[model samples]
Target: MTERESSRYIDATAADWIARLDRGPLTNEEAQALEAWLAGDPRRRGAMLRADALSLLSESAGALAPQFEPTPFAPPAAPPPPGVSRRRMLAWTGVGGLAAASLGVLAITTQPAAAITTGLGEVRLVTLDDGSTVMLNTQSGMRVRYGDTVRRVELLYGEAYFTVVPDQRRPFVVDLPGKPLRAARGTFRVRKLEGKPVDILVDQGGVWLGEAGTADAVLLRANTRLVLPDAAGTPLPVPETISTDHVSRALAWREGKIAFEGDRLDQAAAEFARYSRTRIEIRDPALAGEPVTGLFAASDPAGFGRAVASVFDAKVEQRDGAVILTR
Candidate 1:
């Protein structure tokens, strides 16, 4: 192969590895193969990181510019045509160069607002201009709006954990649809999963949960959780005090792990689905109902399946890109 042709081939291989990693954690064989490929060429590691960063930048730009539905997680049915991957990689190079050049200037300016989103199985930590930080979970979206009067953020969808800086003149407010959560200095988490009530967990200090300028706002204290109502007039449930252990388990995703305590087998499967394209199917109703308790890697559905199979005396089958459990 010519020198340029060989370089393009390496870029294509790196892109393929990144796409596979985005789908789910690699199997043992795939992991070993990737290690071998990297060992063969030192440039391959840098190519992989470059491809991944460019891909993330592309996805972020697409998310902010348009209102389009995100593609659901699914295994790749077939490989791309020859040279297609290389062409895509070449295209990213130009875009990535322009983006990198502009990022430094954008960092220093005061932007009115910015939209951010994370793709499937991706976790991101974003630091705001006001010295606060936000950790976004998988498949999450939000808009950060910092103004002269207040630091406001809109949770468009999904979940985020926030650590707010103490600014008495400008309170930090998180807008959840119609409800607004306000705090001056605190650490908290807000989850707005589809088909479920908005969940608010305060880790340190306190926050006011209600509409802005309202007199009946509820105060949520530290180490407490509240399941806010979806409907406008529905009465809010009292905030429940949570233990330190519970907080650690609930926030386990920060470390790319899922912690379960006597959760149903099917429920755990659904939770894992959020982080991987590999579906875990429970064929037997009895097996699906069995209680499970453990901490598992979020990206490794296949490994989780093996663990469940060993514990329940079930069989684990890999077929059509899914992990099926049978008894």
Candidate 2:
């Protein structure tokens, strides 16, 4: 990699895509974006899956688990229509293969796995091809697997909420990399917290939970709960009335928003910084202690700054495209 290109690794926007690809197949839009990226500059595709390079934030994944090929839950479908291939004939034909070879294929495959990409402060839901879904919270990532025997999803990084459609005989399982938070066959939610404890919140038909290395399993009825990576594998407090409001608030990212209710000002600023590309600098540290409340459009940094300013009698300034919050 050239010095310039190497320097830009941390700034690559395709990091998230690479992470998702690590889990499973890309959607039509993702595939096209990746192909266009490949055609634009060959380096993109190779950089994505190559074991050598690590994401800007994750050094451990640099030694990622083996390349687990993605298999669709159903039969392999037909290939793309003929027109699409004809259009890329020139590029694929390699009239200028030698010249473009320098670009490589990494960019096409790699997706971002930055700490800010799927960490605990935000919630994101991804729709799979088969109508099932995956929800990513502030700081979590899972390796996606869908195949003939089982629809397996490995939580490679942090925490994620999964809602799988029941395939009856073919059960859905969620297992942490080195631990256990297993559940077999049902519609439910399981979150694998990195160091704290893995929590299972069963919302539908009965599901089972077992340790990472043992056969000891327990069946959990609806509205069941448990915290694991723990010794006893104790059942946590399952609120008879599960307040999705907290879940919904925690999961605001799926809607491209961040809802705060009198959360500390500093915390609010930190959350806003994640969705925003440009950095945010608070000029007055004291303001960080102030309380903030309301819904903020995550993609709208300017609007958030205005909201803060107008609500708290603060001032917003822009210096070189970065938001400077001051009071």
In the range 240-282, model 2's lDDT, one tens digit per residue, is 3344344445444434566776777778877776556655677
Candidate 1 lDDT over 92-137, as tens digits, reads: 2211111211111112122236688777777766656654657678
**lDDT (CA) for every model shown?**
0.69, 0.50
Candidate 1: stretches off by over 4 Å: 1-112, 211-213
Q: What's each prediction's TM-score? A: 0.66, 0.49
Most accurate candidate by TM-score: 1
Model 1 steric clash pairs? none
**Each model's RMSD to truth, in Å?**
16.6, 16.2
User: Which portions of model 2 miss their true places by more than 4 Å?
Assistant: 1-131, 135-141, 158-161, 183-242
Q: lDDT, candidate 2, residue 155? A: 69
